[model samples]
Structures are given as C-alpha cells and as structure tokens.
Target: MKFLLIGQGLAGTLMGFRLERAGHQVEYVDAPEQTAASAVAAGIINPITGRRFVKSWRIDELIPAARLLYTELEDFLGVSLWHPQPLIRTLYNRGDLNDWQARSADPGYSEYMEDEPATGRLPELTQPVFAYAGVRHAARVDVATMVAAFREKLIAEGRLTSGVFAYDQVPALLGADAGARNGNPAYDHIICCEGWRARFNPWFADLPHGGNKGEVLIVKTQAPLLNLMFKHRVFLVPLSDDTYWVGATSENQFSHEEPTAKNRTFLADRLAEVLTGTTYEIIDHRAAVRPTVKDRRMFLGTHPDWPQLHLFNGLGTKGASLAPCGSQWLADYLLAGKPLPEEVDIRRFNQPLR
Candidate 1:
C-alpha cells in the first residue's frame, strides 16, 4: 500500500523504512518547520534503570529487534551509527552499593551485573564509591547519523517532501478504492508520528498523552570515556565526533521551549564531578518532549474512528530502545494485516482528552 507518513523523526523514519522494505511505497513529509524530538535525543539504550535497578518494560522482546534494525540500516547506509559500549554505574555511597547487591540477588538483575569491584579511581566524595558493571550490551545510536541515512534514502527514492503538516492537511480516513499512491493520488493511509505534538493533532487528540520534556547537552571531551557510558544521576555517551553527551532532565513541568542555560549549567556541573581532568567544550544544548502516555506505556495502533489513520509514539525517555520495535510492529500490522498488540493500543484508555 502507498502510505503517507507525517514527520521524519525516529518513529516515522523507521516505519517508512520497514514498509518500503516490505515492497510498499511510502511518502514521507517532514519539513524543517516540523518538531523532531528524535533529533535532540541522546539515543542511549539501557535495559536496566532506576535506583531499584529493574528491567525496562519489554526489554527482552525490544532489545534484539532494535539491534537488528540498527545493523540493517547501518549496512544499507554505509555508516557506523550503532555503538556497543559498557555502562559503568558508580555507587555514590556504600548504601547505594548495598542496595544494588541486595537487588542483584534477585533474578531480575542477573543478566545486567557482571562485576562489583572497588574501583578507587573515582572521586572520593562524601559518599563512598563502589564500582559496579551495568548492562554492557547497552547500545547507543547516533540520531543525527541515522536520521540523515534514512532521510537520504527517502530522498533518493523520491519519497520525501520537505514541509510541516498542519492538522487539517492529514486526511482522517483511508479511501476504499485507493491502491499504492505512486500512480495518481498521494496515499492510501496516513500514520502520524509527530511525537509530543500529537497532543495538538486533531487526528489523535483523544489518545491519552502526558507530554514529557527533556533537556540534553553535547560536550567536547579531551578523550573518550570509553568505559561504557557512565551514569550516576546523568549519562555520558561517547561520540565519533570527539564529544560526550551528558544529559538529561525529565521535566513534566516545563514547556517545549528552547534549551535553557539553566539546564546546560546543571548538566555541566554534574559532569564536572565525574571527570577528573578532562577539559570539555559545551558544544550544543537541546530539548524536546517525549510522546508519553499518562501510564508510561508506548502508544501505538489505529485510531478509534479511522483504522487506516494509525499512530506510533509514546517512547518517553527510552525512544532509542522503543522506536525500532514499535515502528516494525506498526508496519507489519499495516502491510500484512496483523493486529496491534493490546497493551499499546490507544483504545485501552478512557478519554475525550482533557
């Protein structure tokens, strides 16, 4: 089927790639006037999170698919975008280490923790330091690189149109007689993947969403952290561009305004505590809201009124690990006439939307 995809962010890009690979033509419309949260994202994929250190939702099913997608796309684009790195989660205090040890005894953490040794190389803050291994299989994707690669292919295939999509322009239903859009009219169906802006989308305003804004920074470090991406309160991702990413602050309180100096300074100060002598340059600062569901689950599946008008969003803070699988699922459902798993279906919520 010929599909019209609004937005060229991670969700839309991946879905477009999947449909095209399945021999369905896809037309992607994403102008610079668009709001792309995927562009500003740090793209760190961690399977375990929080002080309790529990598994992420559906990590088992999600991680493998995401890796496969990255590999396939990297080969297709002739670019090295996915990085497998170590995640060193330092224990700020012995209490933190003790808490981790207790949690490690649970089967939930067995796969993620390899070693918990005393790495004295860290800062000797008031909180005693203990070194612990994080999910080494954790991955990071270069959002800019991946987006460029996908967008390049879309451009080459003549599937990309540069411009923002107003709510009214998106047809709310698929016409019955429409075949693949390449012949005459543009598309058989339209899937909106505009991230947090989905709140404003009349097509999906009823889909329960609690917009979540996050801020991130790119810093030029003298040398790579190379020790997997480190995390305490903040994350540090190494880039081929000789920069490290430190972020982020998940704020439900703020607007989707420009990245503020306040957030940059906050991240920088936190980063300084971790780096001993590495001089860094503050290269860039950015912010965007994740298309979060109020319940914190991914939002997918078709519209209540128009099944052909689908949606794929709500990755929240974990878009790197979530988008690939979510996109694939959406594409499979669209092309092969499969069902969207119940958990992510927007119908699960009760709302006319407040």
Candidate 2:
C-alpha cells in the first residue's frame, strides 16, 4: 500500500518507519518552515510523574517499545539518540517524602520508584532542597536530532515533499480512488500527523484538540551535572557536557506560537532557583504547541466518513514514549486488520468538543 503522511514530526516519522518496515511505501508532505512540537520538546520519558507520583499510563509497555525503537534508530542512522538516566525530583515536605516512601514500598512501583536516590553532582551544584527522590527507568530522547536525520534520509530518497500542504490539495491527491493524476502518483491512504496544526484540519477539527504551547531554553552551565534528570520548579535535563535542556511553561491560552520574552525570563528565573550558585549562559530558547487532547490519550484510527484518511496524533507531552508503541498499534491495525484500543479510538468522541 502507498501511504502519504502529512507532517514529518515524531508521530509521522514513527508511523512512516513502521509502515515501510511492514512492506508499505510511504512518502511525506511536510512544511519545514513551521516549527514542530517534537523539534522543541526535551523528550523526557519519566515513568513516574505528577505530585501524587502515580505511574504513567501503560508505562511498562511504553518504555520497552520506546527503548527498542530508539536503539534501532541509533543503529540505522549511525547517531546517538537515546540516553538512559535516572530521574531525581524534589520532595517539598515531610508529606511528600511519606508519599514517596509509600509508593516505593508497593510491589507494583518497585521497578519505577527508588528507595534511595543517587545524588550525583546535585549537592555541589545547587542549594539544599527539602529532600530528593529517585525514579528508575527514565531516559531522555534527542527528538530534534532524530527527526532531522530522518528528514535528510527521506529527502535523499526523494520520498519527501518540502512545502505547505493545504487541505484543498487533498481532493486532487485523493482523486478517483487516489489513482495516478497528471503523471503524479496517488496514495492509497493519507495519514494526518500534523501535531497541534491538526486542530485546524477541516476533516478532524471537531475532534477536540487541546493545543498547549510550551517554551524551553538551552543553557550551558558552568559546572557539569550529568547523571540524573532533576525536576525542581522546572525540569533540568542534561543534554551533553555542561549544557542542559531547561524549560517548559505550559499555556493553554496563548496569543501566538512564537517564543516570548516573558517565558524566557520565567524559565531563566526557574533555572536560577534550581541551579542556585551555578552560573549558566543561555544558548537558545524555543517554543511550540503540543497536540494535547481533553482526555489525554493519543488519537488514532480512520475518519468516520473516510477510511482512506487517518489520524495519528495527540501524543501530547509524552510523545517520545507514546509514539513508539502508539505507532506500532496504528501500523498493525492498518495492515493486519487489528482492532484499536477503545480508549484511543477517535470514535469515543461522539460530538466535537465545544
């Protein structure tokens, strides 16, 4: 089968990889000028999250799939992509510590929660916090690098169209069972993976896409702290050497997608609070909209009215971990007539979100 994927962000990249591996031909129509959420995301896969510290949804299954796919990409692209690191988060008070201890004692949370967290350079680099807890089975993914490498490979193979793909073009592309038109090949199926931009799509716009904008900063710290990811007021993820990926202020209501001076100052202030005595120089700041859904589950499956049109989006903040397994399920359903999990199926939304 021939599949044309819209947008070459993380979702599309994974989807295309899976489809081609399953013996299908895949091409992409991407707007390189528009910033994708994947490019700006720090791509942290934390098995334990939130103040209550419950395990992420389907984390046991998600982690292995994410690790397998990223490891495969590293070999295929000849570049480093995945870096496994333990996570260390701040415990604000005695109550927080008690909660952590309780969770760690549970057999179900044994693999993800740590009884004793290893504090590497944290003590020397930052001010003393209330306490620290460790989370196992955590990792950071270089999403921007992976997507860029894949884009170059796609361009080299002539399988990519680098331009804006308007919805008006869909009819022509899908003309007469998507047969060849004017010497141009037609696709048997078209999958939309346009990230936050999917909210504007005429076909699936009613599906209640809750787009949230996030801003991040790349800074070079004076001292190196490389062992673990720290989540204080903000997440401080070590990228390489003394450089760290710091960020992310989520805004449900935003005027535009561009990075603002307010957010830059906000993130820098947060970094200062966490890093304490450490000095750092800001190298870059970026912003993009995440493809979040109201219920916080990924969107998959075909359009109710059109079988040839599909959606693989709404991975939200956990795209790095979710995309690998989610794409696999989508590919299996597309190729082998497998059923999609009811939770993620688009049909769950009877009417559009108002």
Q: Provide the TM-score for each candidate, comma-separated.
A: 0.89, 0.95
- Candidate 2's residue-wise lDDT over 227-286, tens digit each? 689999899998888889998999999989999999999999888887876778999999
Candidate 1 lDDT over 69-105, as tens digits, reads 9889898889987887767787667787777777778
Computed on alpha carbons, the lDDT of every model, listed in order, comes to: 0.75, 0.90
RMSD of candidate 2 to true structure, Å: 2.8
**TM accuracy, model 2:** 0.95
Per-residue lDDT of 103 in model 2: 82
The residue pairs in collision within model 1 are 31-163, 86-228
Poorest lDDT segment (10 consecutive residues) of candidate 1: 175-184
- Candidate 2 regions with alpha-carbon error over 4 angstroms: 177-185, 351-354
Predicted structure with the largest lDDT when compared to the true one:
2
lDDT of 2 at 110: 84
TM-score of 1: 0.89
Each candidate: RMSD: 3.8, 2.8
Deviation (Å) of 197 in candidate 1: 0.8
Model 1, 150: alpha-carbon shift in Å? Answer: 1.3
